[model samples]
Target: MAPEMISIHGGVFRMGSDRFYPEEGPVHEVAVEPFELDATPVTVAQFAAFVDATGYVTTAERP
Candidate 1:
């Protein structure tokens, strides 16, 4: 069975921080597009099954 998913609405929101590291400074507004997210994190066994069935290759498996 496929995993459950959550639909997110698109919107603008504040991102980052100005009080922390220099790179994290300059808080600004960010626009987000609608997207779907898995309801829960995938388990190792589930991921392994998916890879076996689809022959999916993870980045870590590549040099």
Candidate 2:
């Protein structure tokens, strides 16, 4: 069975930081829209199965 997904409501919030790193500096406001997210995390076995089924190779596997 598929994992349950929950709806997230859109809202405005402050993001980033100026006190931490230079790249993450300059805190700013961010607005996000409603979205659905899975309630459960995917297992390693599941990911392996997907890779096998799709014949996908990771970057590390590349020469």
Candidate 3:
């Protein structure tokens, strides 16, 4: 069986950080328009299928 897609509602989400990572400084606000996102996070099984078809190897596999 294949994974299902997910739908996300339109809303304003706070982005960035006030005091987290150096690059994350200067907090900012973002507007995420209504859109459908993947219901489940990509799993190893799905990645494996993609690799099997494309022979794709990740950086970790490069040593």
List model 1 lDDT by residue over 1-63, tens digit each.
777999999999999898878898689999999999999998899889889999999899888
Whichever of 1 and 3 has more TM-score, that candidate is 1
> Worst ten-residue run, lDDT, model 1?
17-26
- What local distance difference test score does each model get? 0.92, 0.90, 0.84
Best candidate (score: lDDT): 1
Candidate 1: what lDDT? Answer: 0.92
Q: Give stretches of model 3 more than 4 Å off.
A: 1-3, 43-63
Candidates sorted by lDDT, best first: 1, 2, 3
lDDT of 3 by residue, 1-61 (tens): 7667787889997888977788987778899888876777988898898999999989988
Name every residue pair that clashes in candidate 1.
none
Question: Candidate 1 deviates by what RMSD?
Answer: 2.9
The Cα error of candidate 3 at residue 50, in Å, is 7.8
Cα displacement (angstroms), candidate 1, residue 12, comes to 0.5
Task: Quote the positional error of residue 25 for candidate 3 in Å.
Answer: 1.6
- Estimated TM-score per prediction? 0.66, 0.64, 0.52
Judge candidate 3 against the unseen true structure and give its global Cα lDDT, from 0 to 1. Answer: 0.84
